[model samples]
Target: MDLETVMQELEALGKERMKKMYISNGAHEPLFGVATGAMKPFSKIIKKNQPLADELYATGNYDAMYFAGVIADPMAMTEEDFERWMDGAYFYMLSDYVVAVTLAETDIAQAVADKWIASGEELKMSAGWSCYCWLLGSRKDSEFSASKLSNMLDQVANTIHHSPERTKSAMNNFIYTVGISYLPLHEKAFETAKAVGPVEMKREKKKSSILLASENIQKELDRGRLGFKRKYVRC
Candidate 1:
């Protein structure tokens, strides 16, 4: 679908509703306010909208503004342009679409590396969380991603006891989804498992191992499950 249609379908308001739902009732206690899911396939209608995202971020609609960076392929943008977009990417963007977008087959991985450095918010920093994994996977001479790779890795490592339970579960789901596509990302996902503090991650089976999970909450979103969204939403 076209960017316009995608925007129309995945409107920030819709995401806001989901975000609110997760925060209010869905997210785990540790992850109560953190995001763990992706822009549902239904949300992918937005093909591209870096310009509009700039406008929103400029206007302080941070949620939507950050999403622009998440959806846009970093390669499609100019170096300077990407630097600017990364500047507006809200720190929390990583909790949702940003991580998936960054690790996805976007052209801006290098530019993202540059921008990741520009914004230096320490403590449970999302940029580093995924960037470290990406760096561990592949690199353009290990310069671009490796450039700021160490710093972000430190940010993620330094972050202890940051995520909650529900957030961890959702992250597990999302990471598994990301892994299904790229084997390398699977190893990178382990970074998240490690970042999740020992005390916080109660289950011995790592969060990245979804197959080993309880499978209760995922059934809510799983279409194959008897009580899918249709049945569960009604009840």
Candidate 2:
């Protein structure tokens, strides 16, 4: 479907309650607040459409931007394109979920994510770490370097306490992802999670969230989910 038709369909699916929820999570105007599950039919029809994705993303509408990621052809995108998408990602929902999830589908995911992790920007770092989480959960353990992931666990153990709130959240998730998804570094990740302990993520006008990777890992381990890998990164 074309951008206009897609946007119209998305608007028709919008819900007032979801719109308020998105606004609460940092979304602004021009969004339809279409639930993510509601977009699957559109994705099924459109499959992969780079030009339409670009158009939808450029609209700066939250629902449209999210749907863009659903239909985007990551292979057709370059580092520059990813950067551009990252630029437009105004919140964690867009950054960590949309941009990072889409990036995980590409061969260049790691290289680009590495740059963003070092960028030291709040959402960028969040997306970078989040990209790794997605990658580990979906790809084979062999796709990652054990040494590199070990070093990253060390990095989280060292810097997570001082990171920006969103970055801290992603870093915590990274430790848990490594613990459960990357088999080669599971023990090290568990150690890192223990060392990192609980992270307090301060939210704007909201209660702070206490993130404990160690506890999360243990819960998953109790469920016999260690070394778990998802079949897909995105819906």
Please report how far candidate 1 places residue 204 from its true position, in Å. 25
Query: After best superposition, candidate 2 residue 168: deviation in angstroms?
Result: 0.3
The lowest-lDDT stretch of 10 consecutive residues in candidate 2 is 141-150
Q: Predicted candidate 1: what Cα RMSD to the true structure?
A: 11.0
1-235 per-residue lDDT for model 1 (tens digits): 5445534544433545555654443232222121223443433555555655445334333334445544554445565654454454434443333442443335555445444434444312344334433433343332333324334334434433455443343334434332232333333434543444343444334343232222332332254432111111000
Query: Any idea what lDDT model 2 has?
Result: 0.94
Candidate 1 lDDT for residue 177: 34
Instruction: Kindly list the per-residue Cα lDDT of model 2 for residues 104-202, writing each as its tens digit.
Output: 999999999999999999999999999999999999877888888888888899999999999999999999999998888888889888888889999
RMSD of candidate 2 to the true fold? Answer: 0.7
RMSD of each: 11.0, 0.7
Clashing pairs in 2: none
- The lDDT values for all models are 0.40, 0.94
Global local distance difference test of model 1: 0.40
Task: Judging by lDDT against the true structure, name the best candidate.
Answer: 2
What TM-score do all the candidates reach, one by one?
Answer: 0.41, 0.99
